[model samples]
Target: MIRVRGTVGAWPVDLQIELDDQDWAALARQASAEPATTAAAAARPSGDDPLWSRAQALLREAGELEGPELLAALAALAGSDQAGKRLLVRLRHCDQVEIVQRGEAPLYRWIAQ
Candidate 1:
């Protein structure tokens, strides 16, 4: 059994999950059988991911930036648009970041907490 308690936005979250022996075995197998590349890429914790750090640093230094401009910068930093989008999504959900729409465009602003 696993229990998770936290808050999401304005709501509280309480979650409980149970797994039987077979489920545990299957999960262990899947975890151990993960592709080498995927496992290697995630060898470090998410907080230690260089790209994530760089993305946050970029936003911090910029203070505020337009969505498209930030995307282009992140793309350059990440070497691909798709990776940039992934970083953008991370930033969107980050508590320190606030997004404001100005005439159909979102402005990403960093608010240090």
Candidate 2:
């Protein structure tokens, strides 16, 4: 099962899609068939200024947000999990942000202007 929460045409959407074992296996096989180098080449950031600017804006606007929500939003903005993770790592090193343990998930808090 996969849960998706986002906006579609200015309307907020939250939904879940469930896949059978066969479907899961097919997805796994398809992922494994992809070449690592191809994925790596695609993962490389191209002029990251826009992405970073948007990221900082999101951090400032959110003030404080749960980790999973932040990840999902970042992934949505970035268009890929790899890119989202990269953004999260970059945010982690920023002086204006802080991530702290909060129960099972971390919380992202903006600490500077």
Candidate 3:
């Protein structure tokens, strides 16, 4: 189970997602296959869900962003560096995103359909 609460515009947003063991297994399988997960990720609309869904929205909106920039955005949204890093790692493993070396930092690019 995961919980996230924040604001989108002037509206308050709160989200909680609970995945069963079977769902976890399926999600794990989907994660291993880039194409399948990428497609699944896109199907989820970015509403007010502040957990994994919002993390996806951030990367997708940024398109291509530097590590620091992405980190800062996540921190601002998630409220702490540690929380931000957790989301960052989750985003990193998502199929729609690719992290590459830009200079000394990594550039996160959102792969579009």
Candidate 4:
């Protein structure tokens, strides 16, 4: 399980994803295949940047998102760095997901099972 915590707008959200070793390895392989263009690389947050830290937190929480849904989530979050809002929208559109939350706050945790 990977645990991630960060803010979406004024609210804070936490994300967690459970993956076996094989799944993790597969993701690494896929990421490694992508072309590492300088402009594309620059778009991502640096380790020292606060936004990058937040993005990492969100990614950790997101776990094993794949396909178009994953692309949409990344686009939305990358556009505004609002993971919680982007997640809520994605969950509403996806048919194979389970979302859990504490009360009415924007904070939520989801699994794509």
Candidate 3 on 2-110: residue-level lDDT in tens? 8999999999999999999999999998788778777878966455655767777888987888988899898888899998898788778778899998788899999
Per-candidate TM-score against the hidden true structure? 0.61, 0.56, 0.54, 0.31
- How would you encode candidate 2's per-residue C-alpha lDDT over 20-105 as one tens digit per residue? 99999999998999888889988765556899889878988989878888888888899999888888888887889988997999
The per-residue C-alpha lDDT of model 1 at residue 97 equals 98
**What RMSD does model 2 have?**
12.1
Better of 3 and 4 by TM-score: 3
lDDT of 1 by residue, 1-113 (tens): 99999999999999999999999999989988997789887863477788899999999999999999999999999999999998998999999999999977799999994
Residue pairs with clashing backbones, model 4: 15-61
lDDT of each: 0.92, 0.88, 0.84, 0.57
- Badly placed stretches (over 4 Å) of model 1 are 1-45
Ordering by TM-score: 1, 2, 3, 4
Worst 10 residues of 4 by lDDT: 104-113
Q: Choose the strongest candidate by lDDT.
A: 1
At residue 109, give the lDDT of candidate 1.
Answer: 99
lDDT of 1 at 84: 95
Model 3, C-alpha of 79: deviation from truth (Å): 0.9
